[model samples]
Target chain A: MDARSLSIDGLPVPFDDGQTIMDASLAAGIFIPHLCHHPQFTPQGSCKLCTVRANGRYVSACTMPASEGMEVESNTPELNDKRRTMLQMLFVEGNHFCPSCEKSGDCLLQALAYELEMLGPHFPQFYPDRPVDASHPDVLLDFNRCILCELCVRASRDVDGKSVFALSGRGIGKHLIVNAESGRLADTDFSLADKAAHVCPVGVIIAKRRGFAVPIGQRRFDGEPISRRVDWLARRRADDEEEQ
Target chain B: MSNSEPSVRPATRRCLATTSLAGCFGCHMALLDIDERLFELIERVDIDRSPLTDIKRCGRCDIGLVEGGICNAENVHVLREFRRQCKLLVAVGACAINGGLPAQRNHLDLGQCLQEVYLTGPGIVHGQVPDDPELPLPLDKVHPVHEVVRVDYFIPGCPPSGDALWKFITDLLDGRTPRLGHPLLHFD
Candidate 1:
């Protein structure tokens, strides 16, 4: 009875102390359309995909602390329009060819684009020069598809205790870098078993030798929308946290 | 609104022109994938200039469905002509909207690509990059249809599914703005 509650899009959801708006919402099965947030990681609020209006002000749901009597708006026409713009920017800023990428159906970026009804990559494509590193026998690093979500950075540093990934440079020059001096996944002790390897939300981090294991039509977000998969993903992440 | 003029009440069937520029005709295949529904469609719209109809050029038409990215001088010329002939131009697929797979070479120099594929590539015996006068001059970069001509609508799939095209066609014929929502709105 002492638990405080906030309403997201007018849904009264109760939250225990210390939970962010995102934490309480996801725990209550409300998806905020975030890519940077992981259930177990300390939410860095880097991606800005979780932007929401808290008490009539725009703020990141993952970083904003839940407060009593706080009215938040997560799903609205204006908010979705802004989020759609973000997705479009994400699409154009990198070389994301969903038709060829192995992660097309399973890609969170592509699934979210479909859920939000993104018609095209609205902005001019950067077509940035990127490298494909296949040095690791078990993994492939295709930087062309990175969205700068930093999920792998978090999982590596916090969970695997490897600190193998970090964001380098500044401004548009900012990019993901391998921690090893040799600048390769194989140079570092990055096994396929690491949580970092499983954390990429796009095609950037791919497993080697196992392409199209599941057919595209049957893969994640192919039969159903990402909105429907949020609960299952949330539950899985929660289970992982409990195990830890 | 048809009067008793009878000679011509806009000819009933709206003329539709479709074309592929730098694409593999996969979008056209999707159009054909309309399958038996093609009969219902044929009754409504008349095919004007298309590879399917084997017409050389389209005259004034009602709607134009353009597929593929603009990658050469000929593509630009054809697209401009299509714009002049059609009242409403719809970019029909991922290539037409965002240059799709063909745009992957945007980062590399055109000269470099030609050099690698022809002159310097392995197992080549005196291979030379063709500069034939008959060939269309390549543009420096591939661009979406909207980048070249004003696109009235955009359908974003690698090649949109048959159901998606059918929905768009039915909506256009029914006087509703065509929208591919939810499951139909896909990029790959």
Candidate 2:
């Protein structure tokens, strides 16, 4: 299975043929921060947080394919600083009320911010005046908390076949959108069963009556940071792949 | 190919290829969540162009499972590709079937969205809005994938449970028209 070999951050690593740089790094136990790149999904180079220096050039670790004898630097000070800055930008761009969010303890963005020691967001907060649609009986849509990651949009469109969610605007001001004619979720055919609800990595979309189902002390993956989650997933992935 | 000959051959097993649109990989992942059946499914049919496999497009697939809604030009192209390659196109998740969350912006005007973020926000965007023709122009209204292309099957769920997907898949593979009368699968 030794298809190629690469050096990431000075550590020599072996990778299978067609393995992505992120997969190789993760296999070698190197930590690379990312949001949109899930092992379960297509490696979307959407979130640039996982950008790293590969062979002295900046490239996304998620989408870049690994090759023999390639040199990669994943956690250099400059790259970490850039990632931290980008994360902070995301923080200021959205109203991430950690205390009130259902996904607060389990949120990836929040945990990343903490890991980077983001004491306070530096950029001017874009306290966007967006609405919350509780129109559907089963789910809630709070546009204010959205990061425009396109996860929910992709999940709904690809997984659910509902095409219920979307991004309305462009660039920094972009926000998630719903059906046009039916401003309300109930008006359209959105239900409790839509995949869009799960794609929301934040509290932007929540199961209507399902929040707080687990007590604050007993919530799944609570108190654990996102990096830990990634580590756990990476371990699980290795085990799964090994079994395969 | 005999209509009435009592031959003991299994039903023609079909290969289904799936591609996601604007939604999360949740629905496709949910399909894998069937856990044990997932192992069996890979044996039963050929899986092509799925996020699981890095393949982008496939030709002449027996079934096409599409998730998410079409919001941009890329989505439209992908949907058309599936339609062309798949004989029986199935819209798998709520987004593909109904225009899930992104459609919410259809309530507001695109101009208002621009004003709030650029001209009205606290930060100053120094230059005029770049009128990029390549960017998928925000439609006046968001539409589901099926609205653009005719779909043969529909599976609905917030994220449809793996159990539901398995049932539908098994039925379809068995050459039965999977009946989705349950509340979670299809709502009439």
Candidate 3:
């Protein structure tokens, strides 16, 4: 395993030769805000939130491979502002009613907005009339909360070996579609145990009968911010590997 | 020389006003939830136009706090008035900042909504939509306060917590930018 060191925001991060900037940063316990680039699946680089300036050139960190002696800037004011605008666009593009949402405290999109101090949905609310599919007994698909990250699509395809979700259409007409012939989750083989069912970072694919079970103020990102949680998880994983 | 000198103190209480448009008065209640801090607030500022004061019109004020979305034509008029009168206007909650729950109606037809509530509702006695000219007609869709007028600041919560409001007001008075993050900036 050939390892090289790269600096992200003045912090030295060691990475494997083939590892992307996002992988290196996450492994080194640095939080680069992202929506689509899940560690388990192949990097898609769809959500540009993890975008960074590498040697004066802006590139998606999830897809850009880390190189030794390269200068990468992630947490700058300009970059964060760009990310905030992107988040604002996502907010208005979807009907994210955080107050009534079951995934309020746990939702990554809402958490990232909070992290960036996004004051409000700066863009006009599109309020597209997306449908809620509760056909599955174990899962509720609330399309309103979906930011179209396509994590479920990738996770189902690559990890679970079940392509239960996919993006349909393009531009403003783009949306998540069920893979079943009947266009319903129940018609498909999507169980609550599937990788796709757990990969949704928003309130879209919520497990039924467990709403508010963890309580409002006691959720994952409630006590500690997402960055801290990521750092803690990295450390815990390292500790587990050391024990093994 | 001291005996004939006139007192040189100017009345310097910052005037504050607040109003609710097309939302539940939850945000106003949250404002009142400032509780004992209301005494300190009153000491530093004068309540010119608010639900608490029951003032019909908003006079010229230092700050105006607006809650709820613009659902009707009257909301637009009042919001424009607030923008005109106040030096700094703050959209106080999710409703005022992003249309919140009422904006959910934007998905359906306004006529359908009116029909459901007025005519086809379970407990409808008259079974007809009200046609009084005195009532302000609703806009095609609910809009956040910023869509109607320039909002100087925003506090983005369903109903921003009492403490968050207190901190924001005090920060403004102390001549500092109100920093809403993490614990203070919950949309839910």
Candidate 4:
């Protein structure tokens, strides 16, 4: 219980000097819903799902540093409603046929939608004619399911050092593209083992021929909810830190 | 408090009807999967025009649960009938909410599909695209139930789980807003 602490939803939680609100909250075992703000990657603040009210101002928790004595509001009804709308927009923006998708059970977008109690894709479907890149022998890139989170792009450039993926276009037209001149995944040096392949939050990048291997009922986010898993991960990390 | 107060009577049970258009009736199966708890539900609601009762036509009902996408002219007619007969219309399961498996053929031309299935397909005896006035004409593309008519609610899943259907029905009966939370909300 440090004296310098910010109150999130009236609960006082201490933060390191330079830690973002999301970082502080995660460290304190508070699960704020997010997509693009992975712990291993720098906070891009692209996905606005982690937006929280700090001292009566709405800001992305992943980018905004936690300040002492600040009143931050997370999990409010209004905010949850906004998040639900955002999820709906994402659902319609892409051809996210969750029932037929390989990543449906493990998808963060689908999981968050479930956690938020989004009954349906409230918005109309776009049904974009995006191409599937099954050119790679071991991997497949289904662009139709891409939410434009850019996690794969970030992971490819920052972690894998391949720079295999990048975002193209602007606004609603913005989409993921391959780095190769041929605009095909087969032309790129992307392997099944690349960090980018495993970092997708949705069903965009999948290992070929390995779909539905885990079975529907036994998959991630099937038995336990995503919030519980996040809390469990946070606690495990905290225990590890204490040991070190 | 007066001892001679008027005796209160329990409100009449709400009537509910359900139908499947072009679906596999999996959504209806999920509804039946409510199992022994359906007896408890029976106490609160009167089911009409559902597959369980083998009712062909829907009478006037409070709530209508519709499953499947519109693949043919007959589906459209039944869907419109459900809309007219019910107060609140709920599109249940993936096919009803979105053009589920049937919509997969949406990418290809309907004529091409018919040709491949009938004339060009392997092991066809007297291959012909049947054209009869009595048969329902296939639509150009599979359409979700919402695309054809206004749907009050949508339950998104290949087939929404029995628990999901039960909770939704009970919540509606209780005059509470229906919602599916995690562990109960799945699309596959």
Docking quality (DockQ) for each candidate: 0.68, 0.01, 0.78, 0.57
- List model 1 lDDT by residue over A126-160, tens digit each: 87889899999999999999999998998899889
lDDT (tens digit, per residue) of candidate 4 on A1-244: 5558898899999898989999889988887888887777788898899999999999999999989898999989999999999998897777777878888788889888888888777666666778798899998899988988888898889988999999999888798999999999999999877777777788999888978888887777898788877764345322422321
Give me candidate 4's TM-score against the actual structure: 0.89
| Model 1 lDDT, residue A167, Cα | 92
Error of 2 at B126 (Å): 49
**Residue A91 displacement in candidate 2 (angstroms):** 1.1
lDDT of 3 by residue, A92-164 (tens): 9999998889998888898899899988887788888998999999999999988888988987898779899
Residue A92 in candidate 1, Cα distance off native in Å = 0.5
Per-model TM-score of chain B: 0.93, 0.82, 0.91, 0.92
- What shift in Å separates residue A225 of candidate 3 from its native position after superposition? 1.9
Superior candidate under DockQ, 3 versus 4: 3
The deviation in Å at residue A97 for candidate 3 is: 0.8
Per-residue accuracy of model 2 over A17-101 as CA lDDT, tens digit each: 8899899877777778877766655677987989999988999999999999999997778998999899877865665555456
Badly placed stretches (over 4 Å) of model 1 are: A238-244, B1-12
Candidate 4 chain B: 10-residue stretch with minimal lDDT: B3-12
Tell me the lDDT of model 4 at B65.
96
Scored against the native two-chain complex, candidate 4 gets a DockQ of 0.57
True contacts kept of 3: 0.87
